[model samples]
Target: MSISMKLSRTLGTAFTGLLLAAAISTTAQASGDSVKLEKQDWSFNGIFGTYDRGALKRGYQIYSEVCVSCHSLNYVAYRNLMDIGFEEDNVKEIAAEFEVEDGPNDEGEMYLRPARPSDRFVAPYANEKASRAANNGAFPPDLSLMVKARKGGPDYLYGLLTRYQEEAPDGMELADGMSYNEVFPGHQIAMAQPLDDDAVEYEDGTPATLVQHAKDVTTFLAWAASPEMEQRKRLGIKVMLFLFVWTGMLIALKKKIWAKLH
Candidate 1:
């Protein structure tokens, strides 16, 4: 082939490849988040983002009442609750509600005792077998890193909690235990709709609607996944400011030092 003809063919192929990649990306994004997933207004999103304390507390309440039955929050300790605005005494009281497996009194046998603030969040099932049995052979995942694990983060979780439907969409067929959820990766999820209106009594005047509960729980889970987000952001700001001031000082020193040479 002539040089120009060869170049034209290469260009055409490159353009075609780019178009194909863009199409695939669009399809993947549409499948993941298009109609079903709604973006949430989170307190902790941008550079100055901070957790919404009220929403965090309410989210914790939902997790305690509903999610704890199936999911485990093993990475979280009772003391961590204080980060979300719980008083120290209240955190202690909440921790004490659960019995934690502890010591082998000299005999090397494990025993159960009241949980403390230092104790890790208790798992509902004794073992994986027990947990799977309770959920009809489907293992309930740990909630500790759920928000981070998901692609869409908190919004995807919120959508899953609120978007379950009894009937599958027109072309979809669901397995016996699976239900339809718009935002779930494959459209069929084992988990049923977890929250309903008035499922839990809200201490704050916020109405206990399904959407509200989902939003609160999403906030709580987001905080769980990144409790140090605020600290990290703050540290980052301090470092940037230090660098800026240091750079100015160095520039001035460079000018003063060079004045002698000039």
Candidate 2:
């Protein structure tokens, strides 16, 4: 046999072995305790994708009205709401609704004042200890980076919010105060189901269903995690375009130089 023919056969056998190993690994994972996460078709999904303004507004409403009691968005400020199409005046009004601790007058005493656009979102508890105490020793994590922190990002979050079961499967025992959630690791979670149908009325007349709330909130948190995503994608596109043009020019120059040598 020719050397080239032998090399091709060897390469083909190695590729076949690699494929078989990958298939076995995937089957093992599928048979394990890992839960299959549901993927969502997010508006901000591709290089040209941008956040849905309507969803952002509705998500902010859901977070403020429903999730705010336990989770806090410490990284997001009221002024940032303008990115989601909120007017400056509306943002100010939203900020004013919450009081933040700020002070030290001539008397040197701290006092509570209405929050400003520059201030971060307020925590539900005074501190970590207080937060844990309030929730039966389970601390609620800040939602500011939750989407980025989790394994499946927005998909995992949306699943966690909407996949809660009223009761565990037969023969499964849930610890006291724990909730059953198929998407949550261990099929149990410290936090109970946060959203219900009609949990909050949407100002834009969108359906106030549990699934809708989950999607909107996931989008909002995804935005909060990476507010500059659109800008970054734009820069990437420009860079790619420049590289393509530069490569074509280089190729043409190389051909022109070789023709002179010939």
Candidate 3:
């Protein structure tokens, strides 16, 4: 056999072995011992994808009413809501809801004042120590980069929010302060079930179901993790188009130049 034929067979065998190993790893990850994250259809998924304004708004409401008590979005500001289609007046009203620490004028003492658009989201606790003390030593994580930090991203968040069970499976004993969640790592989590049906009234008349709240909150977190996603995708598309045109022009020029030699 020719050298090229032998090389092709060797490459094909390596690729087949790689695919089999991947399949085995995936199967192991999906076992009962491991967490199974649910798959979700996201609006901001593709190259041209943009956030759903209504969903994002509802998500903000969910995060505010439910997640805000424990988790903080330190990276987000009221002004950032404008990118999600919030009006300037509404952003101001929302900002004013929180009281932030401001500098003293001449007394050299800090004073509490209503938040402004420029202020970052306030934390329930003043410091990490306080946060851990409040939650029985398990620190509540900041939600700003939670989506990007997690392995499964939005799907993991959605599944975790909606996958809580009242009782653990038979023969599994849970420790104090721990809750049962099949989707959570080790099937145990420190946080209790934070969401429920009809937990919050939706202004858009959508049913405040558990799944809806989970999905909306997940979408909001996804947006928070990548606020510039839409702009980046747009730029990427433009770059790809330019490269395609450039490549075609170069190929045509090459053919025209070589034709003279022939």
Candidate 4:
């Protein structure tokens, strides 16, 4: 089928899934908070609490193996590895995995070597057209900055990966170009659930569970989206410490300056 046709189908499926999810949400709200198996989403600072590190690590593995084939994280940098807890050697080792080409100026410059610690993760395809052609005109999005781009990003992403379901036996009506994503826009998605527990080796010793893998990848992607996370955290800490010290000095200065005046 044409790329447009496939995209239309995917969009239709997504729309329906969204509507179903909205209806379900409405019913739950009207019925009050007595629903079973409350699916709590992970967060950096949750309405419930923090996200899991092991989950994030496993998620990175999953992305490296599965989704990376179609999506690209162009916005992430090679140096951000330290924030996600990779050491210098591991970071360099990771950077060396991808070969990036560079060359000198117009004077018969020599080509650069393999990818370094500073280059972004390469896209699986060159551009949108290329990506679409490969996936029946469905544009596999660049994922580097996606977590920041989308609403409820991590939660949305995590849920989407795990929400594939079997369609009802009855002929289900979907949009012009969508599929049934029980957890997607139309509660039906054209892309099948691309993952299962033990989809990749859980090198971190985390249990081989779908939920665990999703969460980990989400975290990794989150870091990839903002390689500056560690720096941000460090800056925040330094700012806090500076404020505390500065406030103490201000109070002491005030006491000294007001002593005789009072």
Candidate 2 displacement at residue 10 in angstroms: 5.2
Candidate 4 versus the native: TM-score?
0.67
Q: What would you estimate as the lDDT of candidate 3? A: 0.91
Model 3 Cα lDDT, one tens digit per residue, 1-262: 9999999999999999999999999887777476656688899988898888889999999999889999999999889999999999999899999999888858999999999988888888899999999999899999999999988999988888999999999999999999999788888899999988998899899999999998899899999989999999999999999999999999999999999994
- Backbone clashes in model 1, listed as residue pairs: none
Pairs in clash, predicted candidate 2: none
lDDT of 2: 0.92
Give per-model TM-scores. Answer: 0.84, 0.92, 0.92, 0.67
| Model 2 agreement with the true structure over 36-74: per-residue lDDT tens digits | 898889999988988888888899999999899999788
Q: Tell me which of candidates 1 and 4 scores higher on lDDT.
A: 1
What is every candidate's alpha-carbon RMSD to the true fold?
5.5, 2.0, 2.1, 14.7
Off by over 4 Å in 1: 1-24, 27-36, 248-262
Q: Write the per-residue lDDT of candidate 1 for residues 69-171, one digit (tens) a residue.
A: 9999989999999877889999999999999888887998999899999999999998899998888788999999999998789888888888888799688
TM-score of 2: 0.92
Clashes of 4: 29
Quote the positional error of residue 165 for candidate 2 in Å. 1.0
Cα misplacement distance, residue 194 of candidate 2 (Å)? 0.7
* Residue range with the least summed lDDT across 10 consecutive positions in model 4: 33-42
Model 2: residues >4 Å from true position, as ranges?
A: 1-10, 13-17, 259-262
Q: Is candidate 2 or candidate 3 better by lDDT?
A: 2
Q: Residue 41 of model 1: what lDDT?
A: 81
Residue-wise C-alpha lDDT for candidate 4, range 177-245, written one tens digit per residue: 455554455464545567778888778676878877777787777766766565566677789889999
